[model samples]
Target: MTTDLTAFAHSVFEAQPFSRFLAAELTDVGPDSAEIRVRNRPELQQQHGFLHGGVISYLADNALTFAGGLALGGDALTAEYKINYSRPAIGETAVARAFALTTTRRQAVCQCTVHMLGDGEERLVAVAQGTIVVAAKD
Candidate 1:
């Protein structure tokens, strides 16, 4: 089950140019969950040396959508989402993990949590909730 979706998930991630630009990698994906990881680079940081809010939002949005798509068994687009920043995000690495909160025939509610890895410990940085609209199958 997971093995099949693993390849599909990686393909979907690889096909996103923006994900590639941000160096976001799809680490895992299943019927109801997905995980992505990105390295902290200077170029991805804000003036305050924290990862920019936009970067965190990007992770949340994409991770949530990927989770929804897996649960829906096809493509989906982000309809809307909101992210709450817990603190200034600083670390050598960052991870976004998303799970389906609810799913319908054409839509899904997903939650994403962002974490920053520093000194071998992970700290919560942001949380997001997203609505995803599944695409019609051909």
Candidate 2:
């Protein structure tokens, strides 16, 4: 079923203070997919002049979590996650695209890929996979 993914993303942003701190924007959200973007700011950079790994991982994780939530049509929490960094994120902005791979009554599995935007090359930065548990509204 189609869902209002933008509304759901906004609710998640409102509930997660750290997502606000990261300045993450939900660019795309559909029944089984979502995308988020974050501009590279000094605070998010490391001494090496590249985006910090943790920040990239966080964005990927959040994207996957949101995708899972969209797929489940309810609140969901990440039960496990894995990330692989492919390159340094040194661009002005990073974008992550997430999509659900599978879903059941209780869980959803999602994957996200992060890339540096600009140059139209869309070079890969990182990839992540997550399993999320659907939860009842509290």
Q: Pick the candidate with the highest TM-score.
A: 1
In model 2, state the lDDT of residue 118.
Answer: 66
> Residue 116 of candidate 2: its Cα lDDT?
86
Worst 10 residues of 1 by lDDT: 1-10
Which number leads on lDDT?
1
- Lowest summed lDDT across 10 adjacent residues in model 2 is found at 1-10
Error of 1 at 125 (Å): 0.6
lDDT, candidates in the order shown: 0.91, 0.86
Q: In candidate 2, how many Å is residue 11 off?
A: 2.0
Residue-wise C-alpha lDDT for candidate 2, range 1-138, written one tens digit per residue:
444556766777667888788988888888877888999889999999899998899889888988898888877888999999998997888999999999998889999999988666678999999998887667
How many clashes in each candidate?
0, 0
Kindly report which residue stretches of model 2 are placed more than 4 angstroms away from their true locations once superposed: 1-5, 136-138
